[model samples]
Target: MYMILKSMKKNKLRNLVIVVQLIFGIVILSNSLANYKYYISTREKAENASSSNVYEVSVENKADIFKVGEARDHQYISGEENQISTVYKIAKESKLVEKIGFEGLGCNSCQYTNEEENEGKFILKSKIKTIGIVEYSKELTEMYNFKMKSGMNFSQYYKSEKAEDVIPMLISPQLSKDNPIGSIVKLPGGGKKYKVIGVLDNSCPLLNELYNMGCLYKPNNGYFCVIGSLLTNKKTHLYIKLKDGVSKAEGKNDFDKKLGEKFETQFFGLDDMAETVTLPAPYAARYILFGIIILVLSSFGIINTVLSTILKRKKEFGTRIAVGATKAQIEKLVIGEFIIFFAFSAFIGLIIAKLISGQQAVWDFSVIGISIGIVFLILVISMIPAYFRMRKMNPVDLVHGR
Candidate 1:
C-alpha cells in the first residue's frame, strides 16, 4: 500500500493519463449501453408487433398505375375495386387463408389538427406528429393478431354485404382509456368522425410508438377515423393472415398464379413489395465493434503506463529483491498497485457518467459487470512486464542496474 501511494505520487502525469483513459473508456461504454438498451427495447416492441403470420399485398389500378400524374385526371374504371373483390373471393375459398383486411395509405409523421375554444373564440391547435391515418377493415384485428383490451373488433362487419352506418375504430390501449368505448373522434380538416369501439393490447409499436411519445394525441390516446374509398382506391394495401404451415413465399406464388390468370396485363404480387417486420437498426454489432476498439486502445495505454513505471523503478525492485523479498511478493505488490488504481478509476468514471447522461441513460448491470471484467483484463495485460521484471530480479542486476 505504501509503495502504491509512493508510485502514484512520483508518477503523477502517467497516473493522470491512466485516469483519463479510464474516464474515456467508462463514458463511452455507458453511452453505448444506454443506446443499446434503447435499441433492444424498440426491437422487442417491433418483434412483438410482428409475431403473427401476416403478409402484405399491394395493388393499384392497371390504368392508374401505368399513367401516374394526377389521379383525378384519369377517367378510368375501378380496376382496384374489382381486383380486391376477386382477391377476397379467392381468399375465402382457399382453406389455407385465414383472414384478410385492407389498409389505406398512412404516414408515420403527420399533423393532427383540432379546435380549442378560448373565451368564446375558437383557436386551432395542431398536434405536429402522428402515425398517419389509415382505413382498416374489421378483419385487420385477425391480420394484426392484437388482443382486444376493450369493446370489440369489426369482425362481425367484415362482409361487404353488411354496410356500416357509422365508422368504427380499433385503437391502442394507451389511446382507449381516455376516449373509451362509444366516444366520437373527429378527424382534422372537418372530415368523417369515427366511433372508438375497441382498444388493442400493449403490443403493436407501429401505432403505439407515436402514441406513447405524446405526438399522436392532444387530450387523449389519439383518434382514428375511416378514410379513403376502401377497395376502389389504389392506395389501399392488403394484409392477409395465412393458415398454419403456410409460408409467405408459398402464399405469394399462389396469389401471383391466380391473379395472373385474371389480370393478364397488370402485375399484382406480395413478395415484390412486402418486407418482414423487424427493427432495421443492427445496433448490436455497431456498438459491440466500437466498444471493442475503444477498450483495446485503452488497454494498450494502460500497458504502456505499467511498462514505463516498471522501467523507472528497476533499482527499487532490485533493492527489494536484495532485502529477501520473494518474486511472488514483488509481483503482488506491483499487481496490487494497478488493482487499486483501476478500482478507484472505475468508481470515478461511473459517477461522472451518471451525472452527465442523466436519467435517460439506462445503466444495464450486465454491461457494467462486463466493463469491470474488462478492467481486470486490462490489469492482467498491464502486469505482464512487471511479472517478467520481478522474475528476473537478482542482487547483481539490482547493484549493476541492468
Candidate 2:
C-alpha cells in the first residue's frame, strides 16, 4: 500500500489523467442507467393504464364558431340544450359502456387560503400557489388507479355524499405539506369552500395521465375536486370504459352514430395516449449507446496507460522480483493502485451525476452493484497487458538494461 501510494505520487500527471477518464466514464454510464430505468418505469405505468381499457373522448360543440382573422375567434355560442350532457346521458344509457366519467378544467383564477385558529379569532395563512385544478368524477379515479396518502379516495365521498356542506377535494402531495386531511380550504371570493377529504399519493396516475393530455402543466402542483354534476356549459372531456369483448373502434363507431352531426368527438385509448407522453425508446437507447462508447474508450485508454507504466517500471519490478517479491505480488501491487483510483473516481462521479440529474443522492443496491461490476471489469481488462509483461520479466536482463 505504501509503495502504491509512492508510485501514484511519482506518476502524478499520468495518474491524474486516468482518474479524470474514469470519472467521466462513470458519470456517463451512471446517468445512462438511470435514464434507462426511468424509461422502463414510465412504460410500465403506461401499460398498466392501458390494461384498464379506458378511453378518452374529446368533444367539440358544432354550434361554436371560429374565424381566421379574429383574436379568440372560437366563440362558444351556447346552444339551447347542453350537447355534452346529452352525450354523457347517451353513453350512460348505452349497453356497451361499462363505466363513464367526465373531467374539465377547474377555476384557474381561484386561490386557496388556509385558515388557522389563533386564540378565539380565525387567521388566514399564506395563500398556496395553485398550479391548476381538474374537476373529475369518482369513476375517473378508479380508471386511473389513483392512490391516496391519507383519508378515503373519491369513491367514498361520491357514493356516500359525506361532508355535504363543503365540496370534497383531493390535493396533491405537494399541497399536503400545508393542508392535512380534513382541512377546510376556501376559494377566496369564489363563494365555494372545499374539504380536503384525501391527500393523493406522490405517484398519482391521474396526475400523470392529465399531464400527458396537456391538462396540467406540472403534475405535482395541482388539485382534484369531484364534479358536483356534469354540465354542458363547462368544456369537459369524457373517460369511457367499454364492456368486455367490445373493441375501441366499435365503441367509437357506436358513439359517432348516436351523436350524429351535432357534436364532434374523438376517442383516444390509454395506450395511444401513453405513447405521446412517455419517453421514446430511441431516446433512452441513445444514452445507453453513448455510455457504452465512453466506457469502451476509457477502458482502452486505461489499458494503454497501464501498459506504458509497466514498460517504464520494468527495471524496478525486476529488482523487486530478484530480492523477494513474487510475480503475483507485483500484479497485486499494480491492480491495488488502480482499485484505489477507480473507487475514488466512482464515488466522485456518482455524486456529480446525481447533482447533474437533479435526483436524490441515495444509492440503491442496484446502483451500487453496477458500480462494483464496472470497476471490477475495468480493473481486470486494464491489468491484462501489465500482467503478461510482468510474468515474462527477466531480473538479470532487466537490471542490465537488456
Candidate 3:
C-alpha cells in the first residue's frame, strides 16, 4: 500500500488524470444510485396502493349554479354529498369494480371550524387549516390497500349509524408510530374527539405529506361532515379499484361511457373519465434513462483511465520483473494501487454528491454499501484489461522499450 501510494505520487500528471476521472465517475455513480433508489421507492409506493387497478373520478361542481350575482352565497352549498353517494352506489353496483372509496374536498387536508364552549354555550374560534382529515370509509381503505400499523380496522360496532360515541378513526403510519392506539385526538378548537382505532401504514405520498403537515384522520361525519363546511365548494374524489382480470378498456368502454352521460344529464359539472385522474408516478423514465447514461459514461471513463495508466507504466513493470519481482507481485501492486485510487475517488465523490444533492441526499449504511459495491465493480471492469496487458509483458522486450 505504501509503495503504491509512493508510485502514485511519483506520477503526478497520470495520477491526477486518473483521480479526476475517478472523481467524476464516482460522483455520477453515487447520484445514479440515489436516483435509482428513489425511483424504486416511488414504484413501491405506487404498487403498494395498487395504482394500476385503482382509478380516481374527480367530482367537480358547476360554479355558475352556486353563484348569486357577483358573489357566491354561503347558504347555497350543494352537489358534493349527492354526487359522492351516487358514484359510490354506481361503483358498488358495477361487477367490474371490486372496491370503492371517496374523499370529500379532494385536497389531502383542509381547514375546519371548531369551537366548543363552556356553560352550555357555543363559542366560535378562528378557523384553522389542518392536514390529513380526509372523508373516507372502509371501502376507501381497501381500495388503497392501507395496511394497519397497530390496532384493528373500524369495528362494525364502532361504525354507528349516527354520531353518538366518539367516531373511530385511523391515523397515518407516522401518527400511529408516534401516538398510542386508542388515544383520543381532539379536533381543532376542541370540537370533536376521535378515538384512534387503527393506524394506517401507508406510503402514499399525499397522505404522508398531510400527516407530516399536522393532519389527523377524523370521521368526516357528524357535525363536522364536509357537506356542512363553509368550504363546501371543494370537490370530492371518488376512487374505484377494478377486480382482477378487468381491464381499463372495459372501464373506458362501459363505465366511462355511462358515467360521462350520467354526469351530463345530472349536470354534475365533470366531463372527463376516471382514468384521466390517474396519479402519475413522481419519477419517470427520463430519470432512469439519465442515470443509465451517467453510469455508462462513468464506466467508460474508468476503463479508459485504468488501461492508459497500465500501458504508461509498462517500463516500470519490466524493471520490476528484471529485479526478480514475480508476476503475482506485479499484478498485486497494480491492483492495489487501483483499489486505493478507487476508494479515494469514491469517498470524495460521495461527499460532493451528498453536499450537492440537497434534501434528497442520504448517507445510510445501504447507500454506503452501494457506493462501495459500485467502486468495486469499476475496479473489476478496469482490471480485466490491466490483467491481460500485464500477462503479456516480458522483461527483455519491456527493457528494450518495446
In TM-score terms, which candidate is top?
Answer: 2
Each candidate structure's TM-score, on Cα atoms with residue i matched to residue i, is 0.58, 0.78, 0.61
At residue 228, give the lDDT of candidate 3.
13
Model 2 C-alpha lDDT per residue in residues 378-402, reported as the tens digit of each score? 7677777767876787767766545
Q: lDDT: which candidate is best?
A: 2
lDDT of 1 by residue, 204-241 (tens): 33422322331112222333333323423443456677
Q: Provide the clashing-pair count of each candidate structure.
A: 1, 0, 1
Q: State each model's CA lDDT, in order.
A: 0.55, 0.63, 0.53
Looking at candidate 2, the ten consecutive residues that score lowest on lDDT are: 116-125
List where candidate 1 sits over 4 angstroms from the true fold.
1-6, 19-52, 59-96, 105-136, 146-204, 207-236, 261-283, 314-333, 340-363, 391-402
lDDT of 3 by residue, 1-402 (tens): 776878778778867776777676667656656654543553455445434466664333333243322222322223656555546666777888777655545243334343333312222111333344555654554444445556665443245435545656666554554446666555444455566666555433332232222221233211121111122334356667777898766754555454543232121111122111122222323443444355446556656766777778778877877788787887888788768877788789888877776343335677668777767775787678777877787767766556
The all-Cα superposition gives candidate 1 an RMSD in Å to the true structure of 8.0
Task: Pick the winner on TM-score between candidates 1 and 2.
Answer: 2
lDDT of model 3 at residue 328? 84
Model 3 per-residue lDDT at 30? 68
Model 3 scores worst on lDDT over the 10 consecutive residues at 267-276
